[model samples]
Target: MFGTKVIETFKEEHTGDVLDMMRDFEVKKRAISEEKEGNIVLRIPAAFAETYKSLNSNPISKHIFKGRFTETTKLKRDKLNINVGVSKQFIARSVSNNIEHAKRILAENECSNISTILLVGGFAESEIVQERIREAFPNKRVIIPSESGCPQRSSSSWS
Candidate 1:
């Protein structure tokens, strides 16, 4: 069928390029599924997926954007730390608010012994976002990964 050819073409051309971009990130885990609307799904390793699953099960935690935010909490040395996604467009506008929320969560958990604050996902790469976070938490160590990788574009036309 025509749809099959389109999917094949997409996999051969576009999908490979996108996956190649993520290759440097050491993305050892990958999952792919076919959707009903002739769409192929690719899931990457991130806390967002877990948060999304939780949002689905709990209506109270519903996010404004369906695909934007994923919140995760981790315990370090008996301190509870929460990380929320700010990469998606809708959530991007409220980066400062999200940072405040994180700080409040950390405070509520009585985690004065907390170590570093980690920022992941695409928004973490923004200079503005980073600067805002640094301004807010001047003393806290903020960690961002080095090999986050870059977006890919077609190189076939160059040759």
Candidate 2:
């Protein structure tokens, strides 16, 4: 079928790309930063920002469009040069402070006998953050949940 050929052609054209087309910068930033494999490069288009302002502010469309912009427009890929950088320095200070705060919490009288450290949330998902926590509390048992983003229910809650 001609439609099948068109779909195949589209898929072939976008085989190695992170997405079929450019999304908003926030989406691109997340995709680039969270990539664990680390070798793939995405060339952000020059017109990437233009898409953000493309929708005109018509009074008729304003009411319906107020909070409904999904930023899902599909645009043609460009060969424009783009650079993205993620720095460990950005998070280093915050992690260090967190480690220090954790130490202070452990120093409290009630927590003196605590031997287990449970790390949760998005920050705990980072290997570097986990390693830092393990290094900070070598004698204590450190636990990182597989689903750090989800809230865990205590055993007492089941009853």
Candidate 3:
């Protein structure tokens, strides 16, 4: 029943809820491909009903636009409407914060003249992150070994 018209109409009218925002972030973390862009749609499985229902008191979370969301059918694939706006600035700012923290530590220790940087975590494996680090510390050497895989793997690999 989730035809093109239904989906489009829902997107146009939905302001989005906290659950939608969280869902989008979760999907982005799993998706490392830089090729994916533009609006992202996520299907809220019926299994997550218990968790979503608990957000009634959240001021930031809005109610799903009533009939916009279809009920739980026998197929278990319910159509729900939720929009989450995410900007690249969010990611850039997060990484920038860490970089700033590193700068602070170096300044405090009077070791501001750092040269080499070894990125070993999975986040370090991110192309955007690697590029950012390179740009931020252009003069310094940034080396990320091939062993750095996903974050979980990267952590264990370093260990």
Candidate 4:
């Protein structure tokens, strides 16, 4: 329950259908550029007040409070590959904050760990948001998939 009642309720729905539809429109509109050059789709957890509260209680919070936020990037290539990066700050704090941290983490690890980064969830739509992520990890590919209901999309974009 961060923004309003509507948003809180929406976030409660684990499926993230509405968010996906909006992102799908963005992909079709090209409002957000796609670097993977394929039909991409992404799904990320919607940040709700409750989710944050839960995160705060997790062991990861220890790292986050220390300005080291770890995010697991899963790229579905011929096989399932997962890479983890530690950011200078917590990504779930705010939209800009999340993107900036994601960028830093990706930049530090993309070359050695991952080939591409998939931006999804609600915060992924911000242009300034994704830009920071892209600028930091220019060598690694970035893809925001066309989502039309439920943030889940194919993992092929990473390959």
Consecutive 10-residue window with the lowest summed lDDT within model 1: 28-37
The local distance difference test score of each candidate is 0.46, 0.52, 0.53, 0.46
lDDT of 1 at 1: 12
- lDDT (tens digit, per residue) of candidate 3 on 1-159: 333443444444453643574556555543443554544345554334333433334221233333523332222234332222233445567779978887777677567767788887656756667878788887889999874653444566776
Candidates ranked by TM-score: 3, 2, 1, 4
lDDT of 4 by residue, 8-92 (tens): 5556664465566456544533333333233233432334324544545532122222122123423232121212111112222
| Model 2, CA-based lDDT | 0.52
Per-residue lDDT of 114 in model 4? 76
**Positional deviation of residue 117's Cα in model 4 after best superposition, in angstroms:** 0.5
Provide backbone clash counts, one per model: 0, 0, 0, 4
Model 3: clashing residue pairs?
A: none
What TM-score would candidate 2 get against the native?
0.46
lDDT per residue (tens digit) for residues 32-54 in model 1: 11111221223322233233344
TM-scores for all candidates?
A: 0.36, 0.46, 0.51, 0.31
**Cand. 1 TM to true fold:** 0.36
